[model samples]
Target: MSFIRKRRSLVLTSTLALSILFLSLIAVMVGLLYKEQKNAAFHGFTEIGAKLSAQAQVSSNLIASVAGAYENKQNPQAELVSSLQLQLNAMIDDDNLTNAYYMSTKQFEIDGQPNLITMIQSSLSSEGSNDNGTDYPLDDVFLDGYHRVMTGETLLTHAYSDDIGTWISYLAPIKDDQGNIVAMFGLDYDYDQVKRELSALLWGVIGIGMLAAAVAIGILFFIIRATVRPLGMLAVAAQEAAQGNLTISMPVTSSDEIGRAAASFNDMIHSLRQLTSSIKQTSDEVTVSSLNLKEFANQSSQATQEITIAIQTVASSAEAQFSSSQETQRAMTEMAIGIQRITESSAIVSDLALHTSERASEGEQALRDTVHQMNSIQTGVLHATDTMQELQLASGKVDDILTLITEVAGQTNLLALNASIEAARAGEHGKGFAVVAQEIRKLAERSRESSDEIRTILQAIKEKTAAASAVLEGSAEEARTGTELVQTTGSSIQSILASIKQVSDLVQDVSAACQQMSAGSEQIAATMVEQEQIAKRSSTNSHHVAAASEEQLASVEEVSGASEQLRVMASKLGEAVSRFVI
Candidate 1:
């Protein structure tokens, strides 16, 4: 990379490192702070737990005092056990308590199976009583303070789980009037709430720590940029120097590392400027010396009349060479023009192809639209077919209804005829009844013919609709095929347009190269004419100054040979330069 690019990249990397380091420091500090806060919170929670345990002891003592007032001969309800249970339940009702239960000691007889009577109040519904005829294990809270309860000291034991592990209970003793252990009371509190609060607090602290880290990173970026600003300025100045603008310089006011770099840049530019000036003067002198040598060589050649006479053929040969060069130049010019024409034609062809592609695209779009419309038409046709099927069913229903009406009409007519016959048996009223029956019979016959004609018309409609649906399906399929063809044509046309665009681009490049060649050949022709004039002038000078043609003639031959060698070298150099196409 260039110096400026490399320097900028280094500065950016340094800034990133500093920012990351600062963020890491912030993380460490925040972590320590959070750890201390978490410890303090846990210590406070432990103290609260101790206080709650102590309070449970006080409530248990009060319950035991109340229970001791009853006589042993009384029933369980009459002995005030219920009241003590109620009081214990009220204490457990506190938000911090989980469960409270009462267990009677005298309720079991065996040593392994300690007598236990479990009592619960309504508020202590989550506490359940298990079989009291079971041995108390070493880990049991009730076993730890068995002596304390026996002594009636109002014992408080640490919290622990029972056999089923439903709740963590703090068990305290209940006593009777004789200062003997009667029962143990307990209060269970949930632990999940405490954990949840701690987790929320941890997340809050982490969120604040992340926010602080982000702020610190932003500040670090600014600080790093301030530190590297002077270096950036020196870097741009150095770039200008490298591009040959040696007068470029950077200001140096500070005594920091960046300031020192700027000072060195100024010193480097000064030295380069001096060196470039010396080199330019030396090159100019060498160019003048080479031209002088060429003139002297022409002069030496002209000193020999024979050589001059032989080279008079050069003017003629040069004319022929010039003519050949002009012809070659003309051919190149024509080729360049032809290539330009071809490029233009290709561009036009590409444009026409693009137009065709666009038209094909439009056709494809139209086909797509037609396909969509055909799909909609097909949907409508299917709906129509459904409607026609429904109509045909309705038509059948109508025919059945007509047949029923005709049957009912016939039945009424038959009933009327029977009534008329009965009337004719009565003789006088029979004539009017007979006429009515005859009219109903004629009307039934006409209705039957009309229903048959309606059925025929419905059958014709069904056939015509079926034929129309088949034609619609065939048309829809043809539309889909046409859409695919149009899309394929559009794709093929687009590919052709792309190929033509590439050809046009290559033709343009060829034309540009040919134009450059024509320009260079014109410059060479002009330079050759200038050299021919200089040769004739040197020949005239040589004729005027010659004191001895023999010595000058020898010099002329030597110079001519040198000039020929120089021309050969120039030709080789031209060939070497021509190897590059552009």
Candidate 2:
């Protein structure tokens, strides 16, 4: 069913059929050879039998005695029969003759009618005794041969079979000294021996035929395999080509039909490969173009989106600008009304500033007196801080005196301990000295205790002195701050007096500046009204631009979709082409 199997089956079937035919031809040839061999064996046996019959005729006397013995139903001379039988046995011993004998025809009466008795043979018995009256079968061929032999003819019998086995007999005539026919000498050639030789030759021919058939079958198997192998390869290549792999080509090994077919198949495959490659390249180009188009569409869409956003921002800014311009126009009208009211208030404020100038001059003189008192207090506080620093130094000197007194007491205690040790060494005589050393030790102890109390009292005085120095430094800093504040107050009062006089002059200038502000506000209002109209037009134009951008974005989206579809189609085409190996 499959291509390769079909091709193989075809080759095998042809080979098998050819083998059968070859075997048949061999069988027929062998049969013919066997027949020819059998015929040759038969002819050779007939010739041999004829030759032996001629040899047997050398003893015509012995053949006559045996024949006469059979005719008279009497035993022949044993010596003469034995000598002839020995000669016949010797002739048969060297060849495939079953018996060498004499045969004769006799006439006898049976049932009062004359019947010719034929095929009467006188042979040596199996025991090598002379037997002269052994009768053979009355075969028609033997009877015919007997008639010929009686007429002084030598005859060779056709092959025939009886109980003694199939044979061809050679019959030769015997004559008296007168040379007339009397009896026949015969040699029986074994037909079975010829058959055995033929059978051996037939077996030899059969062996040779079988060997030839085996060799032919072996050669044919290789030849058929070689013939159909390319066909199988081509079938497989075709199947692959059908599956879109067009890369296979067949090898052409000869100039025969199969080779030519293989060359053609290779050419077809090459053409298919080229076509598939071209298709794949075209598909790739289409895919690339689609991708580029899609990218462009995407860029266009993004640009439109950006443009729409920009326009929307511009429209919003324009709307806000327009609202700000309307508010500015309203603010300008209120500013004009306030400027007129301020012009009337300016004359009244000028008289009040003149009156305040005189009161500020009086306040400046009182602040100067207070600044002088604060400076005096600051000087006194600086002096008290100096005095407290001197007291802290005196307390440090007292602490140093107390340290000297404590050192002197420690020296006295050491001297008293040394004196007490010396007095103890003196024993009863140094008892007074010991009592005096003890009193000195008590005095040194009291002196050390007094010095410790004085150091404590000096430490308390140093603490109080440090506290007093801190309080004086703080009081001095406060006094300096108060002096500076009073001086600043005096300076401020003087500045206020000068400012009151300047305010009187400024009040008059304010009335003139308000008039100028009102005229400028009116001009600004007119300009703002024009700007507001322009902003409103700008907002409307921005809205139009944004709407156009939105429409352009939608168009770009459609183009992007078309590009995407084209890309998809190209990709699918490329994928389809890519399935082929080439």
Candidate 3:
């Protein structure tokens, strides 16, 4: 087994198996034909023996008389003997079925079997070939048959070798008028001649059988080639499909099983093609949505950053205004103290006090006017501050929207990633889909990056705004102190001190209002930072709106399915993220 090569094919196997079977059938046929022919030759010998015995029986009287005449030294009828010889001569010819014939008288038994001596042989006839008469012992080679024939039974012998050649002999007994078996007639057929005939017949049969086997084997190969070649092609096509090449299709050439199978394969390829198309389309949609969401989030972030920067600028300006107001309040406090002492002196001197009172009255009116003017400035600053606070709050709201956009982008990215995984599982055929998924993922990442940059800028603005707000708080505290001093001065120096004090109060109020506005702006800016961060995050995964968007965002689940529920994206990042965030 180890020494032999083990290569096998359908054609080889089929041809080998059938060849063995056909050869075996032919062998059986030849064996049977040969056996039958041999049997037929032996049967012919028996028939000839019987015929000779019949003739002998019909001339029993002549045979008996001839034997009696030879025994008594008298001549039996020559014409009768000659006529019998002539009849026997005809059967002895080379072309005749029987090779030789003889009459033999049974004498004695050896080993319980009768032996014989040939009495009248057919060799003296013109066509005769054998001359062993009276001396040739017939029973040696034909023991079984001769013994049986002497007992009044006809018998045939298998082929045996004699002095002349191999022969099959048949022996029949001849009976006298008294029914006593006197002699036996023997007929012989040449075994060699029969064998030659059988050989010729066998050769003819073999020639035809071999030719038929050759034709059959050729046909077997042709059938296998026709059938198996198509099947092999189908196999190759199937392999391509297995490798994820759904583009391959088999051609149906017939209505046979192979053809039907090919048709089915083509159908399968078509279905797979459609399925891949759907998946690819879904991925493409997700990519577009993410990109759009990213862009929207980025814009919102940038706007928020700008607003935060503007608020920071306003806070810095307010800080400067508050500083100046505090300086003015300090000057007013010093002057107001001076006016109080002066008012004390005026009370002591009458005429001086009268003039002083006149000046004081004018000063009182001027102080009142100054104070009112300062109040108006304070009111204006307060409104400005309030407006700044509202703007910050609005910015925070805008940040919230940005956050939403970021989330949409991030989700779209995730969906694209999932689609890529599925494509990988599908193998080489899914290479195109995988590429789409990669593009989508890249787009999402870009969205996330943009959102991050904007969020950073917003954070920086928030920090600056907070710092400005701190400075404003210090300024506001100083303003409150200066305002208290202004009130005290107004009570003491009713005219002069009052006017200075009122002016100081007005300045202080404006400073305080500006400080409040600055603080509010800072808080608003901080809130905007938080909102922007949220928005950026939202934008980051917002692309894959399928799962999280729709339910989390709404219909982020379906993107649509293969749609099979393509939710992996339907918030599919919310209708391709509002079709470019228009």
Instruction: Please count the clashing residue pairs in each candidate, in the order shown.
Output: 6, 0, 56
Global Cα lDDT for candidate 3? 0.50
Q: In candidate 1, which residue ranges exceed 4 Å CA deviation? A: 1-200, 203-207, 304-582
Encode model 2's per-residue lDDT on 222-313: one tens digit a residue: 76566456645655665565566667777889874445545655654564455446545644654555455456546555555554554455
Give candidates' CA RMSD values in order: 34.4, 63.8, 44.6
TM-score of 1: 0.33
lDDT per residue, candidate 3, 253-326, as tens digits?
89744455456556545544553343344345434433443333233333334433333332445443234233
- Across residues 267-355, which tens digit of lDDT does each residue of candidate 1 receive? 54454454334333332332333344455445334323433343344345655434433443343344334434433443443344344
Q: Please, what is the whole-model Cα lDDT of each candidate in the order they appear?
A: 0.46, 0.60, 0.50
**What is the Cα-based TM-score of model 3?**
0.48
Best by TM-score: 3
* Order of the predicted models by TM-score, top scorer first: 3, 2, 1
lDDT winner between candidates 2 and 3: 2
> Best candidate per lDDT, number?
2
Over the full model, what C-alpha lDDT does candidate 1 score relative to the true structure?
A: 0.46
What's the lDDT of the predicted structure labeled candidate 2?
0.60
